[model samples]
Target: MPELPEVETVRRTLNELVTGKTISSVTVKLPRIIQRPAEPEVFAQALAGQTIESVERRGKFLRIRMNGLVMVSHLRMEGRYGVYQAHEPVELHTHVIFHFTDGTELRYKDVRQFGTMHLFQPGEELVQKPLMKLGIEPLSSEFTLKAMTDKLSRRTTKIKPLLLNQEYIVGLGNIYVDEALHSAGLHPERTADSLKPAEWKRLHEAIHETLERAVEAGGSSIKSYVNGQGEMGMFQHQLLVYGRKNEPCTRCGTPIDKFVVGGRGTHICSRCQRLPRVKKSSGEV
Candidate 1:
């Protein structure tokens, strides 16, 4: 799944490619991918004749703003978007196509067929299902040290899963979570509430620094993720711990370890991120 950096890259590139273009028609070959208006033809008709005003992102969801409607799209695992000439042959797995007035088409392809699109009125989008429940954007100004610590204070769950929760901190997935924890020199198994103030501060800085660098590198292309231009990300080459299992740690010579945390494969440098001693309660063993 594409994390914040990857999603943000898609938003930037897609915005540049599609903004101001008018939708002449829409073809939804897979009706299940369209979740709004309760009907696929309604979605198709609603988008027709509307001009794409902008493309924005909330967490990992892509918001394609039109004249009066907003198309909220979630590109689940293995989903990608591309712009091509209408004369070009539609590739396999292309489930949705928005034909533009300029003889170009914006195509959505998902191998897993797990991608989703919801259409909502412009002002009502945030009040609806998916976007309404998302937490603060980590890259936004609203996500402060106090905000992060406040959210962390309420959880006894393992720090890795807590960070992965979209309700707690939107846009973090498995890859970035592992990378952020490794960057902060914190163990994935550490309890969220066990973090000290210093640890929280370190984590806050690490999250921003890691995400900024990844966005600069167009996000990690660990899987099939690519930008609107179909270019793979460069950040995977600079990864510190994620997907480096059994490889020597960049800081220490210790081999990186891999294990499941919160049901997701997690990577870490044991020497850099030592496990926190399990604390016992007064009545417990």
Candidate 2:
């Protein structure tokens, strides 16, 4: 799944490619991808003649602001968007295409078909099903140290899983979560509520730093991830932990370990991030 950095990259690229362009028509080859208005045909019809004014992201969802409506799109695993000339042949995976007035098109292709699009009225977008439930973005000013600490205080779930929850801290997925935890020298299985103030502070900084660095590197291109220009991300080359399983840890020379945490493949350095003592007392209590 595309995480915060990946989605942010996509948003930047799509904004440049599609904004201010008017939609002349829409073709939805896969009806199941449209989840709004209860009809796929309506999804296509509603987009016709509307101009894409701006592109914004809430967590993993992409919001394309049109004249009077907002189109919320969630690009699930392996989903991507591209801009093409009218003569460009659409890929076999391209399930949706938005024809523009100037002999151009914005195409959506998803191998898994898990991507979704929901069109809502101007002000009703955030109230709609997907975007309404999303939580604060980690990079936003509203996500403060106090906000993170308070949210962490309520959960006994593993730190990684709790961080993965979009409602708790939007835009973190497996790759970045692993990198953040590893960077903070924290174990993935550490209980969320057990985090000390210092630990939370470290985690917070690591999250910000990891994401900022990833965005700067254009996000990690683990596989098939690209910007609007069809270019691969450079962050993968700088990854400290993700996809480095069995490789030497950059800090401690220890072999990086990969394991499943909360059903997600997680990576960490055993030496740098020691396993939390299972029976350690909750020092706070």
Name the lDDT value of residue 212 in candidate 2: 96
lDDT minimum window of 10 residues, candidate 1: 149-158
lDDT of 2 by residue, 106-207 (tens): 999999999999999997988868877878799999889899888776689989999999888999999999999999999999998888889899999999
Error at 180, model 1, angstroms:
0.7
Among residues 3 or more apart in sequence or in different chains, the pairs in candidate 2 whose N, CA or C atoms overlap within 3 Å are none
lDDT for each residue of candidate 1 in 51-79, tens digit (9 for 90 to 100): 99999999999999999899999999989
What's model 1's lDDT at 189? 93
Clashing pairs in model 1, backbone N/Cα/C closer than 3 A: none
Candidate 2 regions with alpha-carbon error over 4 angstroms = 278-285
TM-score of each: 0.97, 0.96
For model 1 the TM-score comes to 0.97
lDDT of 1 at 107: 99
